[model samples]
Target chain A: MRYELYYWPEIPGRGEFIRLALEAGGADYIDVGNRSEEQGWGIAAIETFLGGEVTDFPPFAPPFLKAGELVISHVANILQYLGPRLGLWPGDEANRLWAHGLQLTIADFTAEAHDLHHPLGPGLYYEDQQEEAARRARQFISERLPKFLGYFERVLIDNPAGERHLVGETLTTVDLSLFHVVEGLRYALPNAMAEAEQEAPRVIALHDRVRDIPRIAEYLASDRRQPFSEEGLFRHYPELDSDG
Target chain B: MRYELYYWPEIPGRGEFIRLALEAGGADYIDVGNRSEEQGWGIAAIETFLGGEVTDFPPFAPPFLKAGELVISHVANILQYLGPRLGLWPGDEANRLWAHGLQLTIADFTAEAHDLHHPLGPGLYYEDQQEEAARRARQFISERLPKFLGYFERVLIDNPAGERHLVGETLTTVDLSLFHVVEGLRYALPNAMAEAEQEAPRVIALHDRVRDIPRIAEYLASDRRQPFSEEGLFRHYPELDSDG
Candidate 1:
């Protein structure tokens, strides 16, 4: 089955999370928005996907996945649907729920990271709210980053099987997402995340292991892995980072 | 089976969404955090409930529902789990997914509403970022209010069963959440919502109908229905409500 991902083209943004799993699993999928006009898919094609007569399951926003008749939205929900299909989640119901709980935490962190640059509103330019962004970035760098990372670190340490994965002993989409989140944070808050990593060695180690996976390694080496930039969630604002 | 809900005592906040389904279905449940100290349960009880070391399924935050061995967090996830058990969702898988999609949209709107007041960070006081709050509220009141309400209106109108319910002819949890979202927008953006409602008659009608449900009527009349206030997600800052 072919999976079509619809999201804004230029930035890795939320779409990258979905892209990471699909690429890692070597799934058959197309990045509809990222393709050029010559390939018969672009921003216009993405808009048409959303515009075509709306269904009851219509996505509130992009970063949605369309597989056959099924259209799933919300990053965590989409991943939950894709996890088992791509062999990225354990088959057990309990373990799936545990993985889902972790995914929800990752989603929460992603939203907070986005707010650092656009605290005022997404519709407003980042420059318009740099002052407010600076304030929010401070709280995120100092309090939230440690608290959230510490919570995940404790979860990993508390895993009965070991610190190999977030849920079961096997790799799940939750682990891949954590890897991306840590990567984004490093780019956005290099100094702060560098210090916090000492408190979350398990999380950092899991991230490294995910990168070592052959499929993920190939994807990262290929052009599909979009580079992080100022336009994305984890933008580097010099004022927001500190060694402390 | 009895369900125990753990959330902060006072506000109708996120917990209220869960409360609506339990109340409407006449399910046996306890709002554990709101129980009086004399009754041996209060905020401390809620804290203990949260802090108790548990297995991997533990909720990261409050407003979680404990039913038998399952303890679910994320308001939308909790509602999705309850919707089936409480007869609040269509039994068919497709309809269930559609209902869940609607609930997720409500959750998104709720997050946007909360951000209007705390544009900087939830940890900071609203007074510390009033300027940014004013700017954020403007976008929410003007742009988001119409878009979300308009989407719900379209969903209801497009429902194959009818416009009476969000997903089907039956009253799902999404309907209750939609009612609350409308109530929130009205409280936060009286002028903008008043005007936008002109284009979203179906959404308005659903909100009115949810209020008239017999169990909902009793819940609203009872003290369990907390009034909207400055402390809650929907705040009536006169500066934030405007013709824009």
Candidate 2:
């Protein structure tokens, strides 16, 4: 079945995570919000779902995947649904649950990453909360960043299947998500990430492997892949970043 | 089967969501962290899982569930696992996925509520970040809180099965989680929540309905259910709350 992904047009944001999985898994899908309104798909299409005109189970926000009658929202939830269907996750009960837990952990890390720029609240502009953002970014880089990365590093090291994959012995959606987190960090906190990567060589290797996958490589080089920008989750503000 | 829950011994934090489900479902479970060290449980037992001595899938934080050899982390993941096993969720696939989405939304709301008292970073004390916390709390009570509450209010109104449930016709884990959010908000932001409850009558009613569920009513009065405290997710600081 062809899937429909609804998210903001301009920014990659959380939608990128869903995009990576779809692209790597070679699933047939449409990026609804990115299409022009002239063709009947764009922000208007996304707004329709949120407007309660579509179905009773309205999404809290975008990055929702519409598969026939099912509209799945939340990054982890959408990915968990798409993973097994798209062949991005193993079909075993235990492995699927474990991969989902890891994906949820990534979701937590993504929220924290977004908070580095909007510590006062998402309602406030980054400029209005620059002081608090800087403070949060400092702690995030020094403490939380290393803690999260270190946890993943350990997961990779202890994987009974070896460090090649995060779950079972195959390329699951969890590995794809880890790759995105590392890439987002490298873009958002290059200095700190450069130093932090020393402890997570296996994670970096996993990121590289995902990138080199033919479909993922082609997708990254194509126009569908949006560039990292200030408008998205992982914003790079030189002032808020440090070598620490 | 006896389920094991591992979370911080104190505070009805994220773990409370899981606790409400277990208690409401009348599932046999052990509150591992709350047990004494002499009983071979407590923080030490929780730490053993985190210390990588238990399983390869180490949870990033607490409130993880250990069922047999499988360990599940993240509040939503754990509930999604327990919901069906304990008969708290419908057996159908569509309703289960929908319930999981709603649970994830509650998790997001919980994170934002926690940020009200610790806007700068979770590592910093509320005393140290009071200024930023105050700023965030203002926006939270005014914008974020209403948006979330109103969204759930709409969901309750638009539910095809009627306003009695969030997912299908019967009570599910999502209903229990919504009860906790409303209860926590009332305890943490009484003045604001008292006024805001006006807009979301259905959500408030749903909260009341869940609280009156026979098993839940008993759990609420039992010592097993911990009291909401300042150390938990929804901390009540008079300076950081308002009736907006």
TM-score of chain A of each: 0.96, 0.98
Lowest lDDT 10-mer window, candidate 1 chain B? B49-58
DockQ of each: 0.59, 0.84
Candidate 1 chain A worst ten-residue window by lDDT: A48-57
Which lDDT tens digits does candidate 1 get at residues A143-244? Answer: 889988988888787778788998879888999999999999999989999999999999999999999999999998988778899988778888777754
Off by over 4 Å in 1: A54-56, B37-40
Could you give candidate 2's per-residue lDDT for residues B101-159 as a string of tens digits?
Answer: 89999999999999999998789899999988999999999999999999999999898
On a 0 to 1 DockQ scale, where is model 2?
0.84
TM-score of 1: 0.95
In model 2, state the lDDT of residue B158: 91
Q: lDDT tens digits, residues B87-190, model 1?
A: 89888866766676667778878988899989888888888878888889888767887888888887877788999998878988999988988888788778
Question: Interface RMSD in Å per candidate, to 1 decimal?
Answer: 1.7, 0.8
Q: Give the clashing residue pairs of candidate 2, or none.
A: none
Candidate 1 docking classification: medium
lDDT for every model?
0.84, 0.90
